[model samples]
Target: MKVLVTGSQGFIGKNLLAELKNKEFPEILEVNRKTEQSTLDKYCKEAEFVFHLAGVNRPEDQSEFMDGNYGFTSILLETLKKQKNTCPILISSSIQAELDNPYGVSKKAGEDLLFEYSEETGAKVLVYRLPNVFGKWCRPNYNSAVATFCHNVAHDLSINVNDPSVEMNLVYIDDLIGEFINALNGKENTRGDFCEVPVVHVTTLGEIVELIYSFKKSREERTIPNMSKAFTKKLYSTYLSYLPSKQFSYDLKMNVDHRGSFTEFIKTPDRGQVSVNISKPGITKGNHWHHTKNEKFLVVSGEGVIRFRRIGTEEIIEYFVSGNKLEVVDIPTGYTHNIENLGETDLVTIMWVNEYFNPEKPDTYYLEV
Candidate 1:
């Protein structure tokens, strides 16, 4: 399919065009403010589907709103009409169109024009009255507060919260593209003259700020947010994408001693914790058994021998592990286990426990393995 996307360099345009290319659309025509009329004429004549995403939200002069949103739309449609083309056209409108403002008025005028054209030519037109759209690539300090907040928080800058109680209706970029693709497949969620993205999230302005703050603090906390919630998961991923390239790495606290060091990598309330343990040569660790704090240990450096014995039985089991052949040794609840460094170099083991340690109610008990 030959898909023509207006505002092809914009946030939504970039996302949609990438997805279209990924879907293996044969040909794509990109149009932007700088696009020549001759190129638009050719694209209008050849495009099988038109994503009318070009619009002006912020302009120094108010008249430019109409010129960009309504005027450009008129030009595109008229060119399509002159070419006698009736391919499907999907327009990205805003919920503000219902209000009486310059931008809203321009968007509404564009919608009116598309409807009139659809009526006159009987061409398929899907008008989307989108809420605040956000995700990666959205321009900061633009129309989307979510984008501004994510960017500001990721950069350690202050975010303006004009109204803490104000709730925002957000449509993710991926969700918007999914809806657009559905419209392309002739399966639009339409009602009257407008179409809708099936999935949207609602959150208060204050909560959005809090969520982003938590994401930044996750580095120091060595933890992750609750991912079972759909909105949070998507928002967190979006938040991470906004982090500065140089800020990607964060330091973790490591405890070092003669037996080497141990560091907690990440801790989650429901998923337990992961830690790195380094044992010095000729040193042994974990001559203990747990009632329920089972663990999985994988030696990633040097060589070690992990020995285990049933709590009440005399039978002993031993497993030799090395960096050359990585393997995980499971420490069962009723088994006494110990890992001893056998190589000349220190042994580094990645460990995962079913739960984090609690000094008040430690499940471990010292026992010879």
Candidate 2:
């Protein structure tokens, strides 16, 4: 199908085009500000479906709102009429269309025009009165507070929150595209006079700012964001998209000693912690038993022998491990355990503990295995 998309260079348009290309759509007709009238006429004649996404939200003069939003829409509809095309036309409108502001008035006029055109030509019209839409590629500091917050936070810049309690209804870009694709498939979720994106996230400005800030600090804390919530997961992905290219990588603290080094990779409050341990050749580590803490050790490189002995028992258990044949050794509670590097090179082990180490409690008791 030859799909036509206006505002092809915009945030939403770029995302839609990417998804369309990914889905292996055969043809796409794009119309941007610089596109010529002759080309638009050609696209109008050839298009099987239309995504009328071009509109002006911010302008140098109030008169330009009507010119860009309603006037351009009128021109497009007239051109389609001239071409005798009555394809499905989906328009991106705003909830503010119900208001009396100049932009809202322009958007309302555009919608009225579309309705009239649909009535006259019997064209399928899908009008979406979207809420505050957010995600990757949205312009920062212009219209969306979420975009501004993500950009500023990722860049370590300060953001002003005059009213942190201000609530917002957000539609993710991916969700919007999903709805658009559904409309293309003739399965639109129509509600009264307009169509809906199905899912909307409601959150306060303060909460959004807090989440973005936490994402920035996550690198330093070696922590991952809780992915159980839908909004948080989407917001976290958006926040990472705004990170500067040069600042993509951050250093992790590695504790180095004569035996080798250990580095904490990731820590979670409920899921415990993961660390990378390296031991020099012929070195044995972990001559201790824990009262409650338990761990799992995987030998990922070189050769090693893990030895274990239960508390108040003389019996010893051993497991030979090597990178060539990977296996995990479980260190049970109340069992004194140690690992010796048997190979000539350094031994690398991946360690996972059931809980984050606490200095105050220190459940470890020194014992030989």
Best by TM-score: 2
Residue 94, candidate 1: C-alpha displacement in angstroms: 1.3
The digit string of per-residue lDDT tens for model 2 on 94-148 reads: 9999999999999999999999999999999999999999999999988899999
Task: Mark the 10 consecutive residues where model 2 has the least summed lDDT.
Answer: 264-273
lDDT for 78 (candidate 1)? 95
Q: Pick the candidate with the highest lDDT.
A: 2
Q: Which stretches of candidate 2 lie over 4 Å from their true place?
A: 325-328
Error of 1 at 55 (Å): 0.6
Clashes of 2: 0
C-alpha lDDT of residue 77 in model 2: 100
Model 1 C-alpha lDDT per residue in residues 150-183, reported as the tens digit of each score: 9999998998898899988999999999999999
C-alpha lDDT of residue 117 in model 1: 98
